[model samples]
Target: MKKVDTNKYTKLTLSLERIRGIITELPHNGHRFVVLYDDKPDKQGYIQTILEDDTLGEQSPYLLETRVYHTEDTFSHYRKSCTKAQEIFPYFEDFYKDIPFSYENWEEVTKEFLED
Candidate 1:
């Protein structure tokens, strides 16, 4: 039998206005953002930041980088200025099953999804 991993993953929460501020403050041509997850124990959290490597001419790997902090102390220590709380923990195996658009569309969808 395969060993089952029982760790948890949380959803990082931020206000719509705050998210907008993050977007607005990002440098031009910055990495695009998308929210994606995997089904493994110890999964911490998800972020909407996904990026495609444009320099590669063909079949470049898509980047699924997300910044996840599992503890308030760690989060606070690393992200001292970010006050958003991580309140929702959903198992990775059961979340984001029917994302309506491709990762390439995250910028638009994220703006829409976080709109007030």
Candidate 2:
């Protein structure tokens, strides 16, 4: 089954498997990606970001970091919902900024990366 996000601002509640599927589809190079989902009893949701760490050896060039975002205190966190990095563009707030899209927007964000 496929999970869809009707709203583009709300965090997505999905299983780890689904989240992994989305991660696999994201670009592994040149871009840092974020994945948002609830994998535990906590409904607050988790944000996973993959950064291309040049410091790491060629065999492992990515660094995965996980952060928690509380819905009530979203103003203090990066994105309000689950998000994945679409490109390697620069942002003053960086990945800590609110995500512009939702789970349904996965295709919208990764479209260009996948096509490449």
Candidate 3:
């Protein structure tokens, strides 16, 4: 499993706007890690695990490496966020998932399938 400097993001209080900002504020090109987790059991356990890697595309400092932890758990979370990511930012799935552990967009698509 990969690790992120949680301290880096923890220094800042997170809210919906903040999560959105991380996504919006990131630089255009770079390996990005976008994690969406369930705010249930142990808290955002699964989703956050997904976005801990900043290894996508060629390494680029200009890259906006970040993880967006949303308060969403279960298939519904995936449905909502996945849909919103598409609507919020086209090519959103493409933004992340090339990295390992992603299972590609399939993790997001068959979220319910995987859970069961």
Candidate 4:
């Protein structure tokens, strides 16, 4: 398990763990607040205890409405009980099943994704 820092955009409303994904070069493929720096996702928003939007809420029966981020291709959200930072480790570990790849740097990669 790991901890995540806070992001300025949703800093006050969400927990620090909720907002930490923007700090790393990891591919945040499935989580809403977790933005992938290179992949160019399109939409970002929050889910709550109750909502009408079917695409962005209620994946788990026990959980309330979950926040979600959507790309042109799909939707994503933080896994229940995991911080955005802790959430990344498992996904990245699976991604790098062998050794490593030359991922582009974070700031520039994110900028490049966002610009597209």
Any residue pairs clashing in model 3, and if so which?
37-47
**Tens digit of per-residue lDDT, candidate 2, span 10-55:** 3455554544444444443332354454334544433444535434
- Ranked by TM-score, top first: 2, 3, 1, 4
TM-score of model 1 (CA atoms) = 0.26
Worst lDDT window (10 residues) for model 4? 101-110
Tell me the TM-score of model 3: 0.29
Model 4 stretches astray by more than 4 angstroms: 1-34, 40-78, 83-87, 93-116
Work out the TM-score per prediction.
0.26, 0.31, 0.29, 0.20
- Tens digit of lDDT per residue, candidate 3, span 1-116? 21122324422334444445555533332314444333335443333212222343122222122233344444322322231222333333333222323333432444434444
Ranking 2 against 3 by TM-score, winner: 2
As for model 4, its CA RMSD to the true structure in angstroms is 13.6
* TM-score, structure 2 vs. true: 0.31
User: Which 10-residue span in candidate 2 carries the lowest summed lDDT?
Assistant: 86-95
Evaluate all candidate structures by whole-model CA lDDT and list the values in order: 0.31, 0.36, 0.33, 0.30
The candidate that wins on lDDT is 2
Clashing pairs in 1: 33-48, 33-49, 34-48
- Clash pairs, model 2 backbone: 33-85, 34-85, 78-96
Top-TM-score candidate index = 2
